[model samples]
Target: MPTTEITHALLAPGESELIEVAGNRIRIIVANPTLLVCDYSAAPHFPGPPLHVHPGFDETYIVLEGRLEVTVAEERRELAPSAAAYVSGSVPHTFDNPGAERARFLSICSPGGFEDFFRAMATGDREAIVGVSERFGYEAVKTRG
Candidate 1:
């Protein structure tokens, strides 16, 4: 195994680097080998990423403002302010903003590197996004209409 460096990160609101993907803005708060933290903002009625499974990392979402509909596996629930949800690795999950106002939240992934995947998708190329997601052990599942 290789050694990894651990560094400290301090980001005030609007200070982190923001990347846009599929109409959502994601600010990378931390992107180290052990953990990845991101501040996400989505427009109203935004359908988030496709239902996907991460085979190498667990993800947790902390809702900061507005409401979000989070679906894990086959279950779904609405989260309000200050609410949180956790999805373990290999679980299919996705989230969406169902409120009329913009939604903001913190998304944390363990055993970090998901930020890189998001960055690749920021280019808005479908093929590139799929390739990067596959490289990161992410599998997208087909959702029902």
Candidate 2:
């Protein structure tokens, strides 16, 4: 059997690549071909992107502080600290910070690389975000007639 290389990272506090889009903050903790982890903080009325889906990636969101309102397809819930939600690649999902306090959460994406999108988001260009999102197979949900 052949040996496979492993990827690893050790980032000190405040050492991650931080990106702020709109009023939310995304700190990229680690990004590799197999995994992408980010620490995200959102203010109330989050202004999250539209319900979207990643055709080639699986994502998980875990709340660390305050309250988060997560919607996965037709299911919606308010999650408190320590709560988590798993979203399949093809599912339409989005989230918001419904409470008055800032909400902190972790976002883990498999087949890692949404970091590129976050980086583009830092440019504060909607067109760039759309382009990058498309390149990564992450897009807004389509409506059915």
Every model's Cα RMSD, please?
Answer: 2.1, 3.7
Model 2: ten consecutive residues of lowest lDDT: 136-145
Candidate 1 lDDT over residue span 1-145, tens digit each: 8876676877788788899876788999988888988989988899887898888899999999999999998999999889999999688999999778989999999988778777777776788767767766887787734
Model 2 agreement with the true structure over 21-81: per-residue lDDT tens digits: 8788899998887899999999777756788888878999999999998889998899999
TM-score per model over all chains: 0.88, 0.88
Which runs in model 2 stand beyond 4 Å of their true positions? 1-6, 125-127, 142-145
Give the distance in Å from residue 84's predicted Cα in candidate 1 to where it truly belongs. Answer: 0.4
- lDDT comparing candidate 2 with the true structure: 0.85
Off by over 4 Å in 1: 1-4, 125-128
Model 2, backbone clash pairs (residues 3+ apart or across chains), number: 0
The Cα local distance difference test for each model comes to 0.86, 0.85
Tell how far residue 110 is off in model 2, in angstroms. 0.4
